[model samples]
Target: MSRIHKFVKDLAETRKTPKEIKTMVDTAFEVNSISQSQIYRISALVMAGRTLQTRRARTEKEGPYRRLY
Candidate 1:
């Protein structure tokens, strides 16, 4: 993983606040600043132990079709 992603994951694992994480990430990656809102989004994904696109698919059956997880 990229250093920024690793750093953010570490901080999220420690239960750091979004503000704190944003500050640390910004300081660590001065050339590529990230917004606090983005930090919140990343931290939430990290804490959830999954990525945004990794959700289970809908399992409902439709007449002749069904969704798989």
Candidate 2:
């Protein structure tokens, strides 16, 4: 998972306010700002038990392994 994703997931799970989450994300990423909607969307996914995937994982190729009977 991306560090940013993990950070957001942690804070969201802990019930931190969305504003706090956004502030932390901006500081950690060294960005001028991040949109509140993005934070809300990510937090919703985290609360729903969805795992965040990094870019590499998103494009990684799968190996062919046949299942054993």
Candidate 3:
């Protein structure tokens, strides 16, 4: 699974709050070299039940396989 998907799934399984998720995401970005925008998009996907492909297409112009948030 994608990092975003894994992060969201973990958050859901752990019942993390948005604030907590945001903090975790921020830390993850700093450590993993991921973009903040991607993280935000991923969070949106998790919350809205949107497909990752759609979000990726909207967020980037390159391969959808790349990590998004």
Candidate 4:
């Protein structure tokens, strides 16, 4: 699982306000747990991967091991 996911789960489990959560997570992770820029980067990578898969789906629809399976 992602570090950010763990951070969020901790936040939820603790049931703290936003300011409290941020301070606690930052403290727990030494000020490097989660951030908006990092989340945005992950989202961008996921979207790009999906686009790449769609682009490749037309001519190469199955994996190389499909026939063996």
Candidate 5:
């Protein structure tokens, strides 16, 4: 991942207010964009995200399934 991505991902794994999160993005990108609002929205989603562990999709539709299978 890019440094920026890694930093955001790490932040997402923990807790932070909008101000601190904004500071992080500012330090990494060091520039403003027309899509600045979108960036903030994405950052908020990432910040409230679950564990960074990768998840795979399952096609089966069975009940009480277990990965042990």
Candidate 6:
């Protein structure tokens, strides 16, 4: 995994808040070589508490069949 991924994983494992995670990710993108989109992606993954593969699998299982008028 990338350093950003590792950092986000560690933070999630410690139960970091979304605000804190956003601040850290923003700072990383501004002060480091990482891109903002990359940071956003990592933050989202951490918040979701699962790997991208797992998330995609779950979403596919759930489908997009919503009930509405």
Q: Write the per-residue lDDT of candidate 4 for residues 1-69, one digit (tens) a residue.
A: 566554654454445455665666677678676775544433443444433244346436666634320
TM-score, cand. 2 vs. native: 0.58
Q: What TM-score does candidate 3 get on C-alpha atoms?
A: 0.41
Mind giving the per-residue lDDT tens digits that candidate 6 earns over 1-69? 666667766765677765575578667656555554654565567676667567667677877873221
Q: Which tens-of-lDDT digit does each residue in 1-69 have in candidate 3?
A: 667557755674466665676678667765644454555555666678766677656668665556634
Q: State the C-alpha lDDT per candidate.
A: 0.69, 0.72, 0.62, 0.51, 0.51, 0.63
Q: How many backbone clashes are present in model 1?
A: 0
Model number with the top lDDT = 2
Model 4 segments more than 4 A misplaced? 36-69
Answer with 2 or 6, whichever has the higher lDDT.
2
Winning model by TM-score: 1
RMSD of each candidate?
6.6, 8.0, 6.4, 11.0, 8.4, 6.0
Number of backbone-clashing residue pairs for each candidate, in the order shown: 0, 0, 2, 0, 0, 0
TM-score against truth, every candidate: 0.58, 0.58, 0.41, 0.38, 0.39, 0.45
What is candidate 6's CA lDDT for residue 33?
50
Kindly provide the TM-score of model 1 when superposed on the true structure, using C-alpha atoms: 0.58
Error of 4 at 63 (Å): 19
Tens digits of per-residue lDDT for model 5, 1-69:
455555665664566554665677787688642144543544555755532232112313333573531
lDDT of 6: 0.63
* Native-referenced Cα lDDT, model 5: 0.51
Deviation of model 3 at 15, angstroms? 6.5
Ranking by TM-score: 1, 2, 6, 3, 5, 4
